[model samples]
Target: MTSARRGGRPRSFRSARRVRHRLAADLALLLVAVAFAVPLGWLALASFNEHAGLRTSLPHPFTLGNFQAVLTPDTTYTPMFNSLLLCGSATALTVAAATLAAYPLSRYRSRFNRPFLLTILFATCLPITAIMVPVYGLFVQVNLIDTLWGTALFLATAQLPFAIWLMRNFMDGVPTVLEEAAWTDGASSMQALWRVVLPLMGPGVGVVTVFTFIAMWGNFFVPFMLLLSPDQLPASVSIYTFFGSYGTVVYGQLAAFSVLYSAPVVVLYVAIARRLGGGFALGGAVKG
Candidate 1:
């Protein structure tokens, strides 16, 4: 340290270098933010603009027709209802299964857990496209095709591996001393989990629930493959009809449809954000 100081690089000079590096990082992040925000900004702008096709221009008439166009019975309302039911059911199932599965995995010490966790991590990365063929065949044999509930179940299962992984981490973070007290009070594991652990882990549960709902809400291919009937289709699949293979698209109506279709997911995110406001903290669960 003395030798370095003798080399004439003072502490103030090093601090100045650090400040410059931080400023450079801030500038780089600002550029990246702009890159991401541009498309979203355009979408919002175009949604209000009449006839805003592929070419971008200010809304001459500045009409609300796009919103009006997409809010019809068949285009928005029915499909939105279907999406809510499907996504809500799937998120509930995923959280329940994850909570139960995580409890055992978090509490138990076993030689198999590391490998099981690795397998789950691997499964999380598996693309839906790669697994669809066997999934389709299995559904056909089990009579699950064309059923909305069946589709929701599959979506829940597909989201399970990651959910289990996340829930396990949350469960592990909760101090075992709390559970010990519950056990001392003659409470069963389930009772302790319900009364103690869950109440404390609200933020984590909210995170998993919101993410699972969003994933299922925006899922297009799974429902399209499973739900054969027109009326049964969710908004994600229904929205595709607005675009064309030959570049003949309804840009104005499509933008409106996209915004309307996206509202539920946004609302869900906002609600969850409020729930997770202070972040996940175990607080005074353990008395030092």
Candidate 2:
């Protein structure tokens, strides 16, 4: 009877302790969630409120004027177009170059491979700000400053080292036998990569593309510094226009523009969410 009592007491204590721990964790998570949700809630509510301030509250009298005010050609349309053009081109360039650069590193074992990869990894850690001054000078000398294509090229180069590392890791997951088989059937190295390896690693490509696009899309400093003409400014830089010179801000319009600016990235993620979740699709590919 005494031993049973002792065991029961310990078990009860453990159960109570577990319950307390779980409750604490749940409360912490809720607090974290609320922290993020508050800003988003404010953004949504304030966009429709004419008298929006730095608070989250429902619009007493909702209006579409905020969206209407920001939908003009110069304010929204041209900047959106420029963002799409610049980011889209840069993403394509980054993905293509990363893939080609990663292929040999992933496939062949070379004495220099580890050193090269380490160098690339080190490059990713270097902040863009550190190199921007030299980059700006180089751009000026080449007369590429203020050019969208030039900015896109710089964006691609900036993103490449990380992209190459990511691509190599993904490429490693693909079986070399697939490439070997393609080569046996008269396919060249590039042909095998294009036809066999790339098709298999669709998720990797999608991830890289989305990552590069989103990064460049949200980037303000590089574009602002490189492009002199307001006509060439992306939505990221154009967002500053909502800030008045005398410390006033068009809060409702700013919130509305923020929603629109974020839409494309959300849409892109939704479009590829299924494929990314599907993963490598490599099951049974190497089966005997």
Candidate 3:
């Protein structure tokens, strides 16, 4: 009877402790969800509230004027176009460069590979602000300042190290044996990369593309510092126009623009959502 009581007491105590831990975790997650949800809720509410201030509340009359006001070419269309152009071009360049760079690192063994990868990792950690001064001077020397293509090129360069790192890791998941099979079938290295490895690693490529595009899309400081012309500025920089000359801000319009500004990213994610979840799809490619 004494042994039975002792064992029962310990088991009950452990069960209670586990319940408490689970409750605490649930509470923490709820708090985090609320923290994120509140701002989004505010943004949705304020976008329709014409006289909306910083407060989160329903629109008194629920207006569509804010969206109408920002829908004009100068306010929304042109800047969005610029953002698409710059980010799209830059993303393409970054993905291509990363694929090429990562291929060698993923495939070949070299004494310098680890050191080179470490250097790339270190480069990814660099704050763009730290290098802008020198980069600005170099751009000026090369006559690239205020140029859209120039800005896109720099954005691609800035995103390359991280993209390369991600691509190499993804590339590692693809079996080298697949590439060897291609070689046995009389394919060149490039052909094997294109026809064999890339097809197998579709999800990885999509991930890298989405990541690079999103990073470049939201990057304000780089474009603001490099591109001087107002006409050439992306939506990221142009969004600042919502601020009034004084300390006042058009909150409703700002919220509306913010919603619109975020749309492309949402759309991009949706477009690739299937592929991102597709995994490697390499299950039956090889046989024992």
Candidate 4:
């Protein structure tokens, strides 16, 4: 009886301590989330503020005037449309190219394969600024300046190396026997890839889509240098037009435009989060 009583008290005490520790961790995480969310909340609030209220430290007299200005037919709509088109096209091209390139790299073994994979990995590590001058000159010679197709092509190529590397890693997790079995059943390589491999890679594809879209949408430097016409500009460059070297910054319009620009990415992230859960489950099944 004495031993039982002693052991029971310690176990209960440990349980209580663990509960307290878990509660503390939860609270800490909640605080961190709040801290991160505050800036985004402020930005959202500022987007609704009137132009006169924008300069004030505290938000007062909230109005939709900023959004009205931002969404006005004559404002930055054309650039926003261009940005969406460019990002969508670039992401599609990147995924298609990467999927084709990654399959061979993941499945094959040869001396040349190692060097080729290494080259792609090395390219991913290289800074974009290092090649900008040369790329810009080449684009100029090709007469690709100030065109949406040109920007999409550039972004797709820039994103391709990283996309290939990531897709290769993802493909490695899939079993070769699955493809082999399909081939034994008289499926061609293309058929095996389309039916067996791609369905398993849904998670990687979602990840690639989200990442490529964000990168292409937010890229400012490339568009700024390549696009000379306002109508050809993307949202990233058009947003900067609200502020100039010597002119007064239109903080209200800028904030509103930023909120609008970020909406699509936020929605995509949420959608991808749902797909990611399923992706992990599928990936595990493929691996097992």
Q: Judging by TM-score against the true structure, name the best candidate.
A: 2
lDDT tens digits by residue: candidate 1, 26-81:
99999999999878877777888887776666776798988998888988998898
Q: How high a TM-score does candidate 4 get?
A: 0.81
Segments in model 2 whose C-alpha atoms lie over 4 Å from true places: 1-12, 244-247, 269-288
lDDT by residue (138-244, candidate 4, tens digit) is 98999997788897888898888888877888889888988999989999888888999999888877787786787778787778777888777888888877875
All candidates: TM-score: 0.84, 0.88, 0.87, 0.81
For all candidates, the clash counts are 0, 0, 0, 0
Give the alpha-carbon lDDT of every model. Answer: 0.83, 0.87, 0.88, 0.79
Q: List the residue pairs that clash in candidate 1.
A: none
Displacement of the residue 236 alpha carbon in candidate 3, Å: 0.6
Worst 10 residues of 4 by lDDT: 279-288
Candidate 3 C-alpha lDDT tens digits along 205-256: 9888997898788888899889988889899999887774657889999999
lDDT score, candidate 2, position 270: 83
The sequence of per-residue lDDT tens digits that candidate 2 reaches over residues 1-288 is 999877777777889999999999999999999998998998999899987888777985799989999999999999999999999999999999999999999999999999999998777777787678888999999999999999999999988888888788889989999899999999989999999999999988887788778778888778988988989999999898888574888888899999999998888878867765766542221111
Task: Give the poorly placed runs of model 4, Cα more than 4 Å off.
Answer: 1-35, 52-59, 244-246, 274-288
